[model samples]
Each structure stands twice: as structure tokens, then as C-alpha cells.
Target: MIDPLIVLLIGFSVIGLGILLVAHLFFMDTVQKTRRGMAACAALTLLLVGLQLQHLQHLSSGADLLNSGPYAFMLCAVPAAFYLFSRDVLLPDVPLRLRDLLHLAPVLAAAFLPPNWVAVMSFVVGAGYSVWLARLVYGMRRNVGRFRFEMFFFGLFALIAVGVLALVIALPWTGAPLFYRAYAAAIGVSVALVISVLLIYPQILTDIHEAARLAYANSTLKGVDVEGRLEALNSLMTRDKLYCNENLSLALLAEAMNLSAHQLSELINSRFGVSFPRYIRELRVAEAKAILSRDQRSSALSVGMMCGFGSQSAFYAAFREVTGESPAAFRKKQPTA
Candidate 1:
């Protein structure tokens, strides 16, 4: 009889995969390289889960060794797709070279390995990719504020990667079927976790990509009057209420400050220790707080709009992030005449 725990795990995996497919259809752009790379990662993970399910349930005869080649190939490809996605996000200016193809040489070697050794080879390659990801993440520590919420999701995946490595290391004792079930469960949970984060923070990847550009790329602010430009930016935002324009953007603000978008970005990063978006958000939220205190009867939505938030939801999210309370709650806490 099949183990009930394995059955439960497989069910969770299927639900997570379903959510991922739905998200890819509705949420993903399908054009950007980073999005496409993420889609490939999701598709490959779904395939691995399906294959593991088939093997565990005895859905096919001669499945174990015969299907090993394809499974190992997909296993190796997952990390490759992920690394490409990271590169596209973090270092987009760096052109892809022909030698990058060597990352998949393990798949060719997998065909030569004994069936029992295929899983080991795949895990070894995965460990290397995990280490590479760690290095990339470490290099971005200076921009942690930009990746604050996003880092939690990244750390979750990192922990899952570590768990998979540990599972592979203990394979001699736990055996193949158990390992397959555990791996499937982990992938499923990760897919669901990603979908949930995307639902809540729809702009998570864009924010991270922008942050990575600031972290990994060369400075674009050389020989510039950093102090003078920051003064101008502050005057535009605080004295002139430039942030009150709902259509304001990085390029537009940079133009007003007589700097390039990259220069303005670096200026904010180095001086204010925050991203441009967060800087604008803080200004808007601070204005909203003053408005709320002055007039307690105005609706939060109106206050949000007057302060330049695009919508009520955006205002609430930014306000909570900055102040750790809802607008109404904050207003009520204030001493009203």
C-alpha cells in the first residue's frame, strides 16, 4: 500500500503546480527574458514532480532507469534557468557568452553515469548552483533595504535548497522513493510560496531587479555634484511637492534634478540608504500622516489620493510599511480636539 504521508505530499505538490500554471498564464508577461526564465524553472519543476509522482505510484513499468535520463536532464536545467534569470535581473548589461552553455555539460555526463549515480550527479550540480546563488545574494547586502520583503522569499528558497542538499547527502540511508517524495513536496511548497508572494507583492521581481542593478553594476554618478543634486531633489520633493504628482517617475525626477536615472538611483542608495520608490513612498506617507492629523474626518482614500498614491491599496501598503499601522488606526491614536 502507498504511504498516506506520501499521498498527502503529492496532493500538495499538485495543488501548488496548478497555482503556478495559473499564475504564469495570468500574471507573467511572457516576453521578458527574466519572466521566461522563471517560467522555464516552474515548468521544469512541475515536470520533475509529475515524474516523481508516476514513479512513486507505479503508474508505469520500467520507469525507474528508463526515465532517469530525462529526470536528470531537467534537474540540471532547473539551476541553469534560475541562474540565467538572476543574471537577467541583476546584471542585464552583461551579454550571454557561448561558454555559459557549459553549465549544462552535466546533463551530457548524466547519460554516461550508471542509473544509480544520476541522482548523485544532479544533486552535486545543484549544490554548486546554490553556492553561486549565495554569492550573488551576499554581494547585494548593501541594498538590503530594497530587498527587505523579497529577501524573505529568497531565503525560504535557499533553505529549501539546503534541505534538498541534505536529503541527497543522506540518500544512502533513506533510499530513492523517499527522496523523490521529499523533493516533490519541497518543490510544490516552493511554487505555492512564490505564487503567494507574487499575489501580495505583484512588483516584487521588478523591485528586486532594480535593486540588483544598483548593487551589482558600476556607479553611474562619477564626477557628479552629489551634494548639489541631493539638495535639488529634496527641494523638489519637500518644498515643491513634486511627489504629489501621481505620474512622477525615476526618469522624470532625475530630469528635474539634472541627473540621469542611474545617478539619481545611486545618490538615493548611497546618501538616503533607500530606493527611489521608497523615498517617494515615505514622503507621501508622511504627508498623509499630517493630513490625517489635521482633518480626522477625511476618508483614507481621499488622503491617499491627495498625497499622490495611485490607489487606496497602495496607500495602505506603503503606510503600513512605513508606520506599522493603518491610517485610521494612526489617526485615532492622535489627540483630536
Candidate 2:
């Protein structure tokens, strides 16, 4: 028979590693919401792993694990974490407040109660939070787009938690060892799958942050003359060659155009069908190509620097992506004068 404890331990290890990875990436500015959501998920998974270990060691029954204070906290806090994460991703401008901790009050209260009361409290708390989460998700459904996948996952997680709370309530009275183990295994598998997806597609979090910012920017530009603004933006890029400035940024460009960073981002994304960085890269690549064609003697690195690319690697990547060839390859294809 497969050792369920071993599976739990492995799952915990994977989740722990994912937490570390997310923290590292967050520090590196790789993603916005990973710091909060991934940490909470990992912590909750670790708590469940510990409970399973306790059950395996015969130190506590499944009912005992369910009734534990930490377990109660995890039951309540996990959904709250998901909600906070979604809110942060969807509405980054709204800063997190201390009031959000109120969501955990019920489970904290259950921590001091009897086992039966704890089970009942856990079920009640989980059900209420699940409904709240579903409603929140529904409100965001229109704007979520690619982030809808993440929101869906959290919704499913909340629903599963509700079911698990019900199982916890019944497991002690029924003494169903097989069902308890199955639930434990299912939780372990679900945690592992979420962690794996987070690791593999960390960019999803970054995309959500960007999307939220873009949406905010677009909302602000609602009544403005989009055509005039786009013309002004294009003039700033082409006539002034603003893209040639190595330190050019959305904020700087927005200031120049008398607009907000979000507004400028919205203009670029809506009119040009690209993000600010990609828009800048397209300009820089165009300049680099011109330089390459006109000044064949110029070194690739020097040409890259002259065209606002900070590094040869960035220049080459953008060049290849835009032109479908390396700088040198493109240059070689040009006829000698």
C-alpha cells in the first residue's frame, strides 16, 4: 500500500519550495500577487501536511486534526487569502487594509470551543466564505479574461474546502478510515497541482497586475478624444524620437503628454495593440534596423546602445522577434555598396 504520509510529506516539500520560489520571484519583481497568495496557500498546505503526519503517527485522530486551532485558522484564512489576492490583482490601487482580517474571526472563535462546535463552526465559516468568494468572482467575471482561470481555480478551491468541512464533521462519528485517507490524499494532490501550475506559469500573476493597471487607465480615458491623444502620442514617438531616450518610461511619456501613466499605457495598448515595453521595443528595433542598413561598419553592441537598447541581448531578442532574424544575419543579407 502507498504510504499516505509519504505523499503528504512530498506534497508539503513541493509547496514549501514553491513558496520560496515565489518569494524569490517577488523580490526580483517577477510578479505582483505571488507574495501574498502563494505564501498563504503554502502555509495552509503545510498545516494540512502536519495534520496528516499527526494522524499517521497516531498522535491525533482525523477528528482531532479537524478540531485543532491551527486547522480552524487554516480553514478560515485560506479563502480570505484567495479573496485578498484576487482583489489585489484586480484592483491594485486599493491598498490592503486591516479590516480584511475580520474574515478570520469565526474560525478564531471556534479555536476555543469543543470539537463538535469546532466542526460546526468550520462548516459554517467555510460555506459563508465560499458564497462570498463566488459572488466576488461573479462581479469580476466581465473583466477577468485570462485571469478568469485563476479566479476559477480559487472558486473551485473554496467549494472543495466546503465539502472537506462536511467530511470533517462526519469522519469522527462514522469512523470511516478509507474516506478520511481519500480526503487527505485529494487535498495533497490538489495542493501539489496548484503549486506546480504557479511554478510553471508565474507570468500569469504579472499579466493580471498589468491587466488591472491597463483597465484602470482605460477607465480614466473614457470621455477624452482618443484620436487626438493617439496623434499626440504618435508625434511624440516619431517626431521627437522619444523611444531613443534610454531612460524613457510610461510615466515620463505620460508626463510629456500631460496624461497619467495608466492613460498612456491604455493609449499604447488600445491604439498600437502592444504593451508599452513592446511598443518601445518596436521603435528601438526600427531604429536599430535603420542604423544597421546605413552604417554597416557600426558594431552590433554599439548600434544597440545607440538605438536605446540597454544591452546586446535585449537588442538581439527584440530584433529577432520583430524581424525574424538576428542582427548579424539581417546585416549579412543586405547588399554591399
Task: Quote each prediction's TM-score.
Answer: 0.79, 0.58
Question: How would you encode candidate 2's per-residue C-alpha lDDT over 1-337 as one tens digit per residue?
Answer: 4555745544575565456555644542534444565555455545555545544543233355554566556554555555555565556577657887786676567667776566566556656756765565555443344456667677677666766666767766665454345555656656666666555444345545555566553367777788888889889888999998887876789899888877777777767666676678789999998888888899999999998877777688778767879999989888778
lDDT per model, in order? 0.72, 0.65
lDDT of 1 by residue, 1-337 (tens): 5455556656776776676666655654411344545565566556656555665554334345324666666666666666665666566667778998887687677777765566667767766766776677667767755455655667788788778777776777876666666676677667668767765665455555556778877889889988888789888987999988888878888888888877898899889887777788899999999999999789999999999998898798889888989999999989988
Model 1, C-alpha of 204: deviation from truth (Å): 4.1
List the candidate 2 regions with Cα displacement exceeding 4 Å: 5-21, 24-63, 95-101, 127-131, 147-159, 172-183, 210-218, 222-229, 232-259, 265-337
Name every residue pair that clashes in candidate 1: none
Report the Cα lDDT for candidate 2: 0.65
For residue 330, what is the lDDT in candidate 1?
96
